[model samples]
Target: MPHVIVKMYPGSSEEQKEKIAQEITNVIIKHTGKPEEAISIAIAEVTEDLWIQEVYDKEISPNKESLYKKPGY
Candidate 1:
């Protein structure tokens, strides 16, 4: 099974989130060969003020060893 966590600022509509989840699920199925039923996804919404410490420092910075893809900073 493959799990995906999507973190973004709040305000996206339910319809948009649904499309995003479906699209991402398709991508995961294509790449990892995971079945749709076995995949899990979660969307985490955080405020801009807390984005740095919550995501950048905690996930993008110190977790390089486990990250396979990252955006240019």
Candidate 2:
């Protein structure tokens, strides 16, 4: 069994997380020969204030503005 944990800034949608989990499972299956049923994934969303970039010493804000942008700009 393979246990995968993904940590990202808070505010990701369910659909996005689901897609990420699926992609991670696919990679595990392809490289490690793990069965789909045996793969487990967990996504941990840290709040902006808590998720600080060590090099920058700053929190990364969620990309709320980009969500409404037109596809091609």
Candidate 3:
């Protein structure tokens, strides 16, 4: 089972989130051959004020070796 967590600045609509999840699920299914039911997606809303400490420093910077696409900012 592959679970995806998308963390970003909060502002996206519910429909946008749903579309994002669906698109990700489709890509996962297409590439990994995993069934849609086996995949789970979560979107965490992080404010700009706390982004550096809450996400970038904790997750991205520390885990750069494992990242497929690195953030520019």
Task: Count clashes in each candidate, considering only residues at least 3 apart in sequence or on different chains.
Answer: 0, 0, 0
Please provide, for model 3 over 17-66, each residue's C-alpha lDDT reduced to its tens digit, 9 standing for 90 to 100.
99999999999999999998999999999999999999999999999999
Per-residue C-alpha lDDT of model 1 across residues 2-71, encoded as one tens digit per residue: 8889999999999999999999999999989989999998999989999989999988889877888885
Best by lDDT: 3
Pairwise TM-score winner, candidates 1 and 2? 1
Q: After aligning candidate 2 to the native by TM-score, how far in Å is the CA of 39 from where it should be?
A: 0.4
On residues 1-73, what C-alpha lDDT tens digit does candidate 2 reach at each position?
8897777777789999999999999999999997999999999887666655521133223443544332232
- lDDT of all the models against the reference? 0.91, 0.74, 0.96
- Flag the better candidate by TM-score, 1 or 3: 3
For candidate 2, which ten residues in a row score worst on lDDT? Answer: 54-63
Which residue pairs of candidate 3 clash? Answer: none
Task: Return the lDDT, model 3, position 33.
Answer: 100
Per-model TM-score on C-alpha atoms: 0.87, 0.67, 0.96
Error of 3 at 19 (Å): 0.3
Q: 16 in model 3: Cα distance from truth in Å?
A: 0.5
Leading candidate by TM-score? 3
Say which prediction, candidate 2 or candidate 3, comes out ahead on lDDT.
Answer: 3
